[model samples]
Structure formats: C-alpha cells, structure tokens
Target: MRLAAKANLGEGTISDFENGYRMPNPRKLAAMRRAFEGAGVVFATRGPTLTQPRWR
Candidate 1:
C-alpha cells in the first residue's frame, strides 16, 4: 500500500503491524505516523483511533 511505500517498508511488514503479528521500532512507527498525518488522517487518543480530519 501507499503507506508501505512511503515508509520504505514492505507491504507484508505493514500487514504484520496491522494484524498484530509484529511491532515496528519507534523510528518506523514515527515515520508511519507522519505519513498518515500527511494523508489527512488524524489520530485520536480515545481508544487510539484513526479518523480523517474535519476541515471546515
């Protein structure tokens, strides 16, 4: 997926993180977070949810 490409990681690696099969290092996690934020994703601390930002 685009996230994998942007994170310079393999699709399988992203899948592993999503499926709870593995955990990424702090640096990788930060990279992924930045990528997602750039794509308009806003992370919420309530239950640690992912949501699109509301632009008004």
Candidate 2:
C-alpha cells in the first residue's frame, strides 16, 4: 500500500500496526506523519488530546 511504500516499511509491518499487534517507534511515527502530511492531512491538538488530522 502507499503507506508501506512511503514509510519504507513492509506490508506486514503496516498491518501489524493497524491490527494493534505492534506499536510504531518514533522514527516510524515520523515517517507516517510525513507521508500523511504530504497527502494533505493536518494534525491538530486540543488541550491534552490529539484530534484527527484535517484533510484539505
């Protein structure tokens, strides 16, 4: 999938993350953020909570 290609991660790894079988490290999280942001996703923070990114 695009996420896997963009993150330089295997499909299994992506699947694992999605399935909550594993958690991504800081580096992988950054890669994911970059990939999503490149696709026009913008993350927002409200107080101590994290909200979903706004799509443009």
Task: Report lDDT (CA) for all predictions.
Answer: 0.77, 0.74
How good is model 2 by TM-score? 0.72
Residue 17 error, candidate 2, Å:
0.5
lDDT of candidate 2 at residue 30, scale 0 to 100:
86
What is candidate 2's lDDT per residue for 1-56, written digit by digit as tens? 47888778788888999999999898988888777776666676742222454443
Query: Worst lDDT window (10 residues) for model 2?
Result: 47-56
> Model 1: how far is 15 from its true place, Å?
1.0
Whole-model lDDT, model 2: 0.74
Error of 1 at 24 (Å): 0.7
Off by over 4 Å in 1: 47-56
| Residue 1 lDDT (model 1) | 44
Candidate 1 residue lDDT tens string, 12-46:
88899999999999988998888777666777776
Native RMSD of candidate 1 (Å) = 4.1
